[model samples]
Target: MHITVYGDTLCAQVTATAMAQTGHQVLWCLVEPESREQLAKGRPLFREQGLDLLFADQLESGRLTMDFWEGNPQGLTDAVFLALQPGQHGLAAELTKSLASSTSTGCGVIVNQTTGPVGSAELLRDIAKQIDPRAFLVALPDLIQEGNAFQTFTRPDSILLGCEDGEGEALVRELLRPFNRRKDVIQVMSLREAEFAKLAISGILATRISYMNDMASLSESLGVDIDVVRVAMGADPRIGEAYLYPGCGFGGPGLSSNVLALVDALNERAAEPGLLERVLRTNERQKEVLFRKFWQFHQGSVAGKKVALWGVAFKPGTHRVDNAPALKVIEALWAQGVKVTAHDPRALADLGQWAQGRGELTLCDDPYEAAEGADALMLITEWKPYWSPDWQRLKRVMREPLILDGRNIYEPAFVREQGLVYRGIGR
Candidate 1:
């Protein structure tokens, strides 16, 4: 079981480390030179929980090795995994061609975990087959959830495997046997179906979130608690609670890009305007819900005001802020001449980098420090540390005791009892 994994994505890291942990010798070919340099220095490239330690252990035990993507795999490689980022289709094709060219017998089963448009895997397979007819390409579309990526990969609820050939399916199944132990959760399908299924899953989840945000808006006008309505909706066995929370909005590399890809696919197919289009529009508007609340609370005279943001990461348990709602919120606040101070446990460094030349942003180590003398406090990411805070201290430090709960993590009545004005997405 000698596997070579390509790309510097979290999927690449997780796949390499997990396969090594399962007794396979894995050579991780990182696409980014910086990632290889950091790995050589024993520094973690990703901040996923427990991933660094496990990856380190595998490296120490000689089970996992790191190399650059520009380098060829040493000796005969049994399998290849491409976990590249979206828009790396050319790179994927190049890698498949190189592997196929180098292999005298076959390139083996090339598993594509990369996120790309439909038919991408088939295209790679066609390229590989030109060099070696035995070379097989399969699609194992990435379903890794950030923040909890390692656990989700090691124990996925189900795996979408796209393999047209019996031998390819058998090879990939053996490679993933350790993770697929619980009741055989692997759903076999055509390559195009597998890719489309992943995008459809993301689309539906985004749709649910946008739908909830839409309901939250209506709930506010009706003076009804969206949380209550959410609970009632979840009580239905048919609905089953998941991605139904009425937050400011949903943003991350995965959901946003997949929805956009789905939209593009629909458009290319000459489909009419539909739910997904509305879903994206609603989400964009929802990202500004907190900003609108602040402006309305101040009667539209919010220039030169100070606001504190509790979290900036797209979600809790990860340090990435790609397409995070906090960015939009910060931009809106800055346009209104509002000073923004933010605090997040792990995302400050990333947030600082993102804020470069965008506008003035004060990053604070402590949550209360961010809130100091601020007119309002906006909870953007709903990190666990921000769940329970020093209410009295927040009340004392802020110039105006205003709390805008974007994620509905705080109880509105309890926040008001602390003598602070509370404004949630829909309380």
Candidate 2:
């Protein structure tokens, strides 16, 4: 099937590659001319582990192709998947209008791969119906994670497709025929149900992170080790183990927005249990976990302090810094007139734009370079480089060798033996 995708920015690129990998031809329409130019020059738009490899394969195979459209002037496909962001949260309507105008229309499955809450699908379904009642618009939302979207595409465990009727359902199954297998996870459900399930899952995961952070705080004051608590909690067969490894907090594209949106929607409905409310509150407090610990240790004022920050991205293995706790803490430090030098393995571009005109902030290649002449060091992301560092060399470079390990990826005795004040989350 020669399908035309609206946006081939990042996830769209992955989606197109995934489709083309299965022998289907993909005509990816980028949002901007510059983006097309970048692709033409072979410059990648974003970073991911296995994306570049797949992209190279598809490009060579001629199955994946790129084009730039000034506007969606009108074309058609067997189906259209709106894998777009909530730019003013109005791109859905715009795509629907363009889809209506497309001359070669037919009975196809329009999948909503964008991450959004309930009611977005119903609204899109209504819009598609306005265009052609026969054509089906379903919310076969993508549950892809950052740094792991390609892996999820190649080997998805479950696929929840929401549709208005069986027509959309059957087409969706055919669309994802390459992935569906025995004990098929292609669950067919109502549009509303599937829509909310995505948000609900994210909400629950974020809540788990925040809840762990909350425990970490209590552990600090009560003289109990949160790591011990985590081990005990995960020991339960019913509980299992996942996001219970206590850290600073949860921060990323999907989790942050999804949680906040869920909280707002649930608040408006007045039917939300108090648990969701607490989750949002806890997460908000959780983002400040590292900073709060720093403040208390440094008395009331952090002024004139030279802080070394490790990890700029929200999490390791990716360069997305949307709601990273590292940025938040850096801003707070700047506001209080504290000097900060930060380092990351891969988030230089995002951090560079963020540090514009801020002469105090330095984005360093070497983590230890940032540590030089610093009062304290804060590990915001669990980058593998940070897990094992030359602590003795680090101690020699810094003025005051106090360490704050936010991700809890360090050994206590070893750090102490290195003659450093090592503080960590929970334990």
In candidate 2, where is summed lDDT lowest over 10 consecutive residues?
Answer: 68-77
Q: Which tens-of-lDDT digit does each residue in 58-154 have in candidate 1?
A: 9999999987866564456788999998999999988888888884433568999999999998999899889888778899999999989999999
Question: Which tens-of-lDDT digit does each residue in 1-427 have in candidate 2?
Answer: 7666766546687788888898887777777666767668876877887887888899899998877756563254676777776442377677776676566654266777776667887887788778777657788766877767788876788888887788777777887888876558787788888878888888888878878888888898899888889999999998868889888777777778877778878788786465777976777666776777778788857888889999988887778788888877888788888898899888877888777886568778888899999988999998887888998999999998889888889987789998999899988
Off by over 4 Å in 1: 34-43, 71-74, 104-106
Structural similarity to truth (TM-score) of each candidate: 0.97, 0.92
* Backbone clashes in model 1, listed as residue pairs: none
The superposed Cα distance between candidate 2 and the true structure at residue 239, in angstroms, equals 1.6
Q: Would you list the clashing residue pairs of candidate 2?
A: none
Query: What's the distance in Å from true for residue 142, model 1?
Result: 0.2
Badly placed stretches (over 4 Å) of model 2 are 32-43, 73-76, 87-89, 105-107, 271-274, 357-359
